[model samples]
Target: MPRTDKASRLIAAPPARVYAAFVDPDELLAWLPPGDMTGRFDHFDARTGGSYRLTLTYPDAGTGKTTTDSDVVEARFVEVVPGVRVVQAVDFVSDDPAYAGTMIMTWAVAAAESGTRVEIRADNVPDGISAEDHAVGLASSLANLAAHVEN
Candidate 1:
């Protein structure tokens, strides 16, 4: 069954600033998680047809012992409307049984009375990926973004 995860937050920043948060790799690296996991951009072009790859390490959660590994992932920008919306399709590139295929993710920014309302929707997840996992990830990413922009 196809799965979808949706999450939203009211950010005090403007839409443009929030939108730029996704385009810049350095900014993304500052906020995107698995908190301890770090990533390097093989590509960072932010346009339709543009692609990106990143290495993600899953370290021991308790010991903080680091593991060096990478996922040969790829993503294509599906849509981008400055200060309004961004969408992409991304997938894992590994033979490991834990890693699967592609998924569609959409981020929208809408102006509100107080600030911009940011919503992230991940849709069409492959089987075995749960909506709860996506929801937690989205919540964490947004919280990280808020922290980055606020501080």
Candidate 2:
């Protein structure tokens, strides 16, 4: 069976602002990367069936892990609903056979009492990615988002 990762957080921002953080390339760069990583998008189109390429780079070496300079992702939007949801088809650019297939990442945004409830679900995860690491990465990204939007 394929592996999946799910993470959720209550962001201290409205649904529209939280949703905008995902689709806006500039906002994405501010919050998408986890921990000591940074992100840059080649180009972004915020519509159904639109595609984008992003590069994530790690700048620090203290994590005790030998890592690549960058990880690239080529993704397309499968579904897009303003302030509500986004479903993406993502493929990592890697030579490893285990990471060759396409995975689905869904972002569900809902209106909560004071802010927005954001949930992320990643399905068909590549075997090359460690589940524990991915969980940390997901949680980290959410925390980054909260920090970006709440301040």
Candidate 3:
């Protein structure tokens, strides 16, 4: 069965600033990867129907990368609303069969008294990505986002 993972964070920034982090490639590369992973984009277009390919690599040899030391994802923009939300249809590019299939990921940003409330929701997650691990990854990414936008 497919799983769903969700994570929320209260970032010390406005909605537009927080939302820009996802729309801009440089900003996205700055905060999207979890842990010590570094990200590089093959191509990015932040409009509906636009697609991008990104590779996130770990310095070590055995970091969930069997074929290579990088986790690659190809994603298309399903919906993009400035300062509000972004919906992406993502596919993990891996030789590992467990990582196959498409996932729907949503980033929702809302105005708050002090800052913005950002929530990330992923649906139809493949079994390859365990819930526990996904949660940790999401939380880490959110924290990184907070740092990138808040600072």
Best by TM-score: 3
Segments of candidate 1 deviating more than 4 angstroms: 61-72, 96-99
lDDT of 2 by residue, 52-142 (tens): 9988888854332224677889999999988799999999888777777889999989999989999999999988788999999999999
Candidate number with greatest lDDT: 3
Candidate ordering by TM-score (highest first): 3, 2, 1
How many clashes (backbone atoms < 3 Å, residues ≥3 apart in a chain or on different chains) does model 1 have?
0
Model 3: per-residue Cα lDDT over 19-132, one tens digit each: 989899999999999999998999999999999999998878676543458888999999998879999999988888788889999999999999999999999998888899
lDDT of 2 at 128: 77
Worst 10 residues of 1 by lDDT: 59-68
Clashes of each: 0, 0, 0
User: Which lDDT tens digits does candidate 1 get at residues 40-147?
Assistant: 787788887787876555544332112235444678899977778889897877554444657788989898887789998888776655567657767888988888
lDDT of each: 0.74, 0.88, 0.91
Candidate 3 Cα lDDT to native: 0.91
Which is better, 1 or 2, measured by TM-score?
2
Rate residue 53 of model 1 by lDDT: 78
Task: Show the colliding residue pairs in model 1.
Answer: none
